[model samples]
Target: MIHEISAVAFRQNLGEMLNQVQYRHDSILIKKDGKPVAALIDARLFERIRRMPARFDALCHRIETAYAAVPEAEGLAEIDAAVAETRAGR
Candidate 1:
């Protein structure tokens, strides 16, 4: 379960919160004025998401290269057609 705490409380217990996140894999949601402002999560999960953008950009570049000969509008239409066909089967 996630633990929710105010920003002021979190600042006072920074070390303890870090330990809980590192050792127990607990997520702490930090709030300011009752609105969620940040989160303390396991390092492993953070690293995975941190690296995703680069990998995603590379994949998009490859797809764009493969579809280079097709006009932008036509390529989008083709993609829409493919998605519609796949969804129709389900």
Candidate 2:
């Protein structure tokens, strides 16, 4: 679950919010001056994110290989069609 609270409210209930993060794994977005300033998340999730290396390069390599195997314009048209279908909620 995602929860949002003001910085002042979060400070006032810091202990309870920590418990919620630790036990319930709920993410918290803390806003200050009517804008998002910080987030509170479970430590385990943070560690997992820290441990993972970004895979954008691998994804780009796969896309390049796929495009190379097909007519580039056709592949791009297919991709555009798929994106349009997705955006149209099909």
Candidate 3:
């Protein structure tokens, strides 16, 4: 579950919020001045989130190397074909 709270409210109920996240795996979205500013998520989830950027970079690098020898137009045409096939529920 997810809960949205103002910054002030979060600060005031920090202990309770932490308990909720710790025991129930709830996520807290913190806002300031009615605008979203930050979030409080489970530690394990946070760890996974922290690793996403490195994983994404590695995936991009692998794709780039795999397609390095392909011509731009040919690559784009293949991508378009694949997208169309997927959209058609192939």
**Which has the greatest TM-score?**
3
Q: How do all the candidates rank in terms of TM-score, highest first? A: 3, 1, 2
Alpha carbon lDDT at 85, candidate 1: 100
Candidate closest to the true structure, highest lDDT? 3
Q: What is the lDDT of every predicted structure here?
A: 0.95, 0.91, 0.98
lDDT tens digits, residue span 3-82, model 2: 99999999999999999999999999999998999999999999887766556667888889867878878888999999
TM-score of 3: 0.86
Model 3 regions lying over 4 Å from their true place: 87-90
Weakest ten-residue segment in model 3 by summed lDDT:
81-90
83: Cα error in model 1, Å: 4.6
Q: Backbone clashes in each candidate structure, one number apiece?
A: 0, 0, 0
Error of 1 at 15 (Å): 3.1
Model 2: how far residue 26 lies from native, Å: 1.0
Q: What does the lDDT read for residue 80 in candidate 1?
A: 100
- lDDT by residue for model 3 (1-90), tens: 999999999999999999999999999999999899999999999999999999999999999999999999999999999999999995
